[model samples]
Target: MYKHILLASDGSENAVRAAKEAVKIASCTQDSVIDVIYVVDFDKSKSDVLHSGSSEAIDIERRKKNSKVIQFLNDANVNYKTTILHGKPGPEIVKYANDKKVDLVIIGSRGLNALQEMVLGSVSHKVMKRVNCPALIVK
Candidate 1:
């Protein structure tokens, strides 16, 4: 019965699965909106320009990741919006969800190895700890 759902995607297979699940949730909740966010780690990019080809690259990647979800939402007549943020994925997602007051946060598991996750800390794990609302993590 969530009125607003946030879907965080990084264009991975697990992310696509999470998008599909968010779409399904949106379709079932009347007057609900699905907010999709893709975070770009601009700080990590070696490119010096802020508004250069990197912007284009981000747009292309967003479109590629969002097309299927958008199509499904359109077919289901669900309302949705997308946003691109520049920051670390976990913190960005948590901030967006809180700022937008989303009722739920749905994200994909990065499928990192246990040792890698222990060392690097997966985004989903961070979101789960930081988000105020409920979070659904899809693997």
Candidate 2:
């Protein structure tokens, strides 16, 4: 019975899987509300800017990336709101989950940046370790 669920998404395949899991879990309780967060990685944002040519373009691309998850929740009748945050994904998601006092945090095991995850670590790993609530990392 998780009343407050936080889903950290990066629009990757695994993220869609996580979104599915979030919907299933959130549906378990009538009062559940999901907080979807798409954190724009600072380093990746620079690359996106260079490829996109403008901030507005970048925003559009971001929305397009996350649209599937949003649409899925809508079709499933799950109550959720998405917030876009600009920062390092791991820290940003952790801060948001803790600050919002969510009861559950769900995220994909991997993200859009596979090389970065191999080089440094995964955003899901960081979130699972730091969140104040139960963290569900979907593979």
Candidate 3:
């Protein structure tokens, strides 16, 4: 029954599954729009390690991933829009939902246990706590 659905993706397989689910839900509802967001978190150490040879390569790869996600939406013929943001994944996702006044959010859960979640905070947990909108978490 969601009018505007916000789906967060990290280009992971789990996220991709969530995207497919969101699209299916949207297809059943009339006048519904799906918003897909990809967050690019800036980790200097990770960036340095990954981009040892060239930073341009990293940028190109990021763009390619973003393009692939957008292409998937187009190929599916789903009414959707894509947003690429730079920030911590959880907060950025929550903020975008609130700012856009989305009816619901569909997120992928990494299936982290309490201990693992405590050590490395899960994005789904953080967004659940912070987001005012309803969330449908997919595994």
Q: Highest TM-score among the candidates is held by which one?
A: 2
In model 2, where do residues sit more than 4 Å from their true spots? 47-57, 111-118
For every model shown, the clashing-pair count is 0, 0, 0
- lDDT string for model 3 (12-128, tens) is 777777888888899999889999888888764386457656767766676576665566677778889778787899999999999988999999899989899999999987887
Worst 10 residues of 3 by lDDT: 44-53
> Which lDDT tens digits does candidate 1 get at residues 1-139?
8999998987667777888788788878788988878787867455535544776775775577657656655676668888878889999999999998889999999889999999998999999999999999998
* Candidate 3 C-alpha error for residue 114, in Å: 2.9
lDDT leader:
2
The residue ranges of model 1 lying beyond 4 angstroms of the native Cα positions read: 44-58, 65-77
TM-scores for candidates 1 onward, in order:
0.82, 0.85, 0.81
lDDT of 2 by residue, 1-139 (tens): 7999999988777888999999999988998999999988778866897898788998898999998888888898989998999898999999988998999999988554777877988778888999999999898
Q: lDDT score of model 3?
A: 0.83
